[model samples]
Target chain A: MKDNVKLMKGNEAIAMAAIRYGCDGYFGYPITPQSEVLETLEAQMPWETTGMVVLQAESEVASINMVYGGAATGKAVMTSSSSPGVSLMQEGISYLAASELPALIVNVMRGGPGLGTIHPSQSDYFQATKGGGHGDYHLIVLAPSTVQEMADFVSLGFDLAFKYRTPSMILADGVVGQMMEKVVLPEQRPRRTEEEIRRQCPWAVTGKDHGRTKRNIVTSLELDSAVMEKNNERFQRTYREIEKNEVRYEARYTEDADYLVVAFGSIARICMKAIEDARKEGVKVGLIRPITLWPFPYDAIREAAKNVKGILCVEINAGQMIEDVRLAVSDSVPVRHFGRMGGIVPNPNEILDALRRDFIDKPANAKED
Target chain B: MTREEIIRPENKVYSRPRLIDDNYMHYCPGCSHGVVHKLVAEVIEEMGLEEKAIGIAPVGCSVFAYNYIDCDWIEAAHGRAPALATAASRLNPDKVVFTYQGDGDLAAIGSAETIHACTRGENIVIIMINNGIYGMTGGQMSPCTILGAKTATSPYGRRSDLNGFPLKVSNVVALLDGTCYVTRQAVHTVQAVRKAKNALKKAFKNAIEKKGTSFVEVVGTCSSGWKLTPEKSNKWMEENMFVNYPLGDIKDTAAGLEEKTVEVKKS
Candidate 1:
C-alpha cells in the first residue's frame, strides 16, 4: 500500500470522499449493504473538521427533501440509500430534476422487485439509466466498479452536477458497496464560504441581499401548460448537451476480438476476468465498461461492434443493459444477454461458458443472419 | 383636506409591507391565506430580514406564496415544507427560514415531516393555516375538519365512528421537547389580525435566534370551501372552529414560560 492507499469498503470510500471533496452536507437513512456509509460519516465526524453536516434522517423521503433544501441554497448536498429506500425517494428525485437543482444521490443497489435480499444485484440499471422517477427527466448516472472508483466519483459527480445544475447518481451494486479494496483518498478541499456560494450559484435561493439582488425562487411547479412545455424543452436541451459531451466508457482488447462483453459496475470486473480467460483459450474476447450509464457509451460500443461478431451483455440481473447494447449496435452485430438473477453473482467460468455456448461453439447468431 | 394633503406620509396610518409583491393573489375572497401572507411579509420586513429570508411554500392555496413574498423561496412538495425548511435553516443558521402550510398539507400528507422536524428541534418557523377543510381541491374533508362538520367528502356530516376526530396538530407539537414556542392565533377581526401578526413576528425572531422549532397555527376561514360568503365564513370560523381549535399559547419556552416543565432533548 502507498501513502494515500487504504483498504476500505466502497461504502466507506463514498463517505470519506464526500468529506474530502468539501460536500456541504449529507442527509441519509441507513439501509444495508450500504449502512456503512452513514456509520463511517458518523464515526469520522466531518462536521468537526470540514464542517460538513451529516444527519440521519427519519426516512429516505425526508432525507431527499433535506438534500433538496440544501441544494436550493447552492450547497453540495447528498443522500445515499439502497433500493427500497431509493424507491421511496422517487417523488423528491423527480422534483429535484424538475427544479434543475444540483445534488448527489448514491444508490448501493440490492436485490429487489420487493426487498428480495440484502445481497448484490444490478437490477437497477434500467431504473438508473432510464427515468426511475416520474416526469421526462434524466440523472447523470456514474456506475462505479471498484473501491477506488467509489472514492473518485464523488467529486466527479459533484463537478458534473454543478456544471449542469442537475442531479447526479452513483449507481453502485451491493458487491462494490461491501467488498474491500485499496483506495487513494483525495486531498481535502475546504468548504466554500457564504460569499463564494452566493457568487458561484447566483440562481440559488440564498435569500435576497436586501434588494441588492433579485429574489431567487427554487421550485418545479409551473401551472401554465405553454410555459411548462418550454421548461421541458429546456431540460431536453440540457440532456442532449450532456449526452453529446459526457458519454464515458473504458474499452479493453476489442481491437482484435471476435466477441465483446458489455457490462458496468461490479459485473464489469467479473466480465473482464471472463474475457481474460477466453483470450487465453485462443477465443478472442474483449470488454466494454460504461462509466456513465445515462450518457451511455453508445458510440464506443458501436465502434467496438465493427470488429466483433457478437456482443454479450453480462449483468447481475436478467438482461437490463442488453436493450441499450442492442440499440447501440442496431443489428449490425448479434447481441445477447447472460446474467444471474436474485442477488446471485455469476462466476467468470459461468460467463465464459455462456460466451462459448452462444458465440464461439454454436455461432447461432451467424446462421440466423 | 386636499388629496395631496390626505396622502401625506404624516397622514398615513397604515401601509402594505414592502416585501409583498404587486401581483394579484389567487386566493378566494375572504380566504385567510392572504392575510397570513401579508403578516409573514410584514414580519420579515420589520425584522430587517427581507433579504436573508427563505420561505418554504407547501402544496395548497399558499403554494404561490413565493410570488407574493419578495424573498428567496422554495416551493416544496405537498406537505414536505418542514423537511425542506429543516435543511435550509440548519445550513443557513444566520438567515430566516420558514414554512407556510395549510391543514391538509400539514396535518395529513405531511404529518410525519412536520412532527419529525419539530422533534428534531430544527431552528425553523412553521406557519400552519388550519381552515378545517381542503380549500384547494374543491373543499374536501381534511384532517382538521371538525367533528359534525360537512365537506364534499364528508357530505353526511362527519360522524365520530365514520370520520376521525379533528387533529389538533399544534397541541401535538407543543408537547414535543424540541419546540421552543407553539401558539394558535386567527385573523378574522382587525384586532385579531394585529395579534396574529405579533405571533408571526415572534416566531420569525425565534427562528433567527436558533431556538429550535417555532410553530404558529392560524385557525382561519375558507369562504368558498365552507359554501359561505366571506363575512359569514369568518363568523362561522369564530363560532365553530374556535371552540375546537382554541387560540392562545400552548407552549412558550422562549418567554421562559414552562422552562422547568419542558425538558429539551438535543438533536
Candidate 2:
C-alpha cells in the first residue's frame, strides 16, 4: 500500500481500496457525503481494466439486494451509502446477516433523527454496532477516523467479513468522508476465479458441480421455531467469539493520565486533538479510540480505568456510546458524557474544556477519599 | 409383447427431468406451480446449464421453488429477486441466472426493482407466476388481482375505486426498449403448457446468449386460493383470465432475430 501514495477524500479511498481488494461487484445508490465513492468508481472505470462490475442501482434497497446477489455467487461485493440510504437497506442487511454471507458496507454517516443534516455526526454508532435491521443479528463494525483509515479499513473490513461469513461496515462520518488526506492505496488484486470462489466459500450458491450432490440454497426463513432459535444461538456464540478475539483499540497518553476520553470514528480524531492539547497544559488526560465499535474494547478500557480518576465519553451526538463506556468501567470510576448533536461536531477546545470541568477540576468526593 | 418391448426407450415419451429433485413441491394439489417448475427444470436440463444455472426464488407461493429445482438457489427477500438476479447475471457473466417470482412479488412491493432491472437491460430471466391472488398468504389480493375478484383481503368483490386496477406488468415491461423478449402464456391446457415451456426455453436461451432481460409471465390458476376446483379454475382462466391477460408473445425483439432483415433468396 505504501508504494502508491495518493491524496484523496475518504470516500474515494474506499472506492479505490474496494477495487484494489479485488471486489468483483460494486452496487450503490448515490447520496451526499458518500456519493463521491460511487462517482470515483465510475470515473476510474475498473470494469474496462479489472473487469470489476459497477452498477448505479435504482435505490438503496435495490443496491443492497444487488450486493446480496453478488455475495451469493461467492464474489467480493460491496455498497456505500449515507444515513437515509443505509436505513432503507436494513431489511436486506438483516437477510444477508441471516444468510451469513460475506459483504462490505460503508456508512459515511450524516446527522439524522430523520434527514437531519449533511454535515458529519456520529449518530449511527448504536445502529451499526447493534443490529441495524430486524431480527437478532450483528454486523462486524469498523469505525475509521482518518482518510488513510478509510482506505485501510476497506480491506480489513472485507477480510473480517469473509473470515466470519458476516457482513462488515466501515462506520465513518461526513467529515472523514468529505476530507482529503494522504493514503497509501493497496495494489490491485485480481478477482478470484470460479474454482477459487467455490473453494473459499463452499456454502455459497455457486452452482452444483464436481460431484457435489447438494446444491447450495441460501435463505433465512426457517419456519421451525426450534431450528431458528438454534440459528440465533449460533450467531450469539459467533458474536461472543468475535468479542473475545477481534477487539481492537488504540490508547494515547494513558500511561500516566488521570482522566480518560472515549470516542470512535470522526469523534475519535477530535478527541485525539483534545488529548494532545490537554497534555500540553500538563493535564493528565488520555484518549481511547475504539477501532471496532461492536466488540467495544471493554477490557482495554477496564485496564485504563485502573489509574484514571474517571472517563469522559465524547461524541458528535447526544451521548449514545456513554452507556457502553460505563459498562466497560463497571461504574467503579465516575463516568460522564459530553456531546453536541445535530450536525455539530464540537471543537477540540470544547472537549478539553469538558475534560477540565468533568474530571480535572472536580473536587475529591468523600467516598473516593 | 414383453414389458420391455411394450415400453421401449424409444416409445417412452414422458419422464421427469433429472434436475427435478425427489422432494415434492409444497404447492396445492391443483396449483400450476408444479407444472411451471417442471418446465423450468426441463429447460435447464435440455440446455445443459444444470451446472451453471442459478435460480433466485421469490417470497410467495413458489418461495419454495428451490426445493424442487436441483440448482444453485437464492431465496431472495420478497420482491427483491430482480435486483439480485441483475447482480448475479452481470457479475458472473458466464453463469446463467434467472428469478422465479409470483404476481405479488413482481408487481407490488418489488415493482421498482422489476421495472428498473428491465430498463437497465439486465441479462436475466424473470419467470412471473400471475395467479391473480396471493396464494401463499392464504389468498389475499395481489397487485395483479382482477377487478371484482373476491380474495381474502377483498372479500366484497374488488372495486376499481376502492382497490387499484390490476397490474399488467408484462405488458407494461414490454414497452421498455431494454427487454429483448416479453411473453405471457398459461399452463392450464396441454397446448398452453407447451407454449409456456417454449417461452421459458427462449428466456433461458436469451440469458445463455447474453441477451437483455427476458420476461415470461405465465397466467396460472390457484384453485385453492380462488375457492374453486382445479377444473373450474382452469375453465375460469379460459373465460376471464385470458380476457384481460391474453396469452401470447407480447414482444419478441431480440437483436439477431429481428424479422430477418437480410432476406434469403429461395434457391
Query: Considering every candidate listed, which one attains the maximal TM-score?
Result: 1
Candidate 2: Cα lDDT at B54: 91
**TM, every model:** 0.97, 0.96
With a 3 Å backbone cut-off (N, CA, C), the pairs that clash in candidate 1 are: none
Determine the TM-score of chain B of model 1: 0.95
* Chain B TM-score by candidate, in order shown: 0.95, 0.92
- Per-residue CA lDDT of model 1 for B26-80, tens digit only, reads 9988999989988988888888887779999999888999899889999899889
Which residue pairs show backbone clashes in model 2? Answer: none
True contacts kept of 2: 0.85
* Model 1 docking tier (incorrect/acceptable/medium/high): medium
Tally clashing residue pairs in candidate 1.
0
**Interface RMSD, candidates in the order listed:** 1.1, 0.9
Worst 10 residues of 1 chain A by lDDT: A360-369
Candidate DockQ scores, in order: 0.77, 0.74
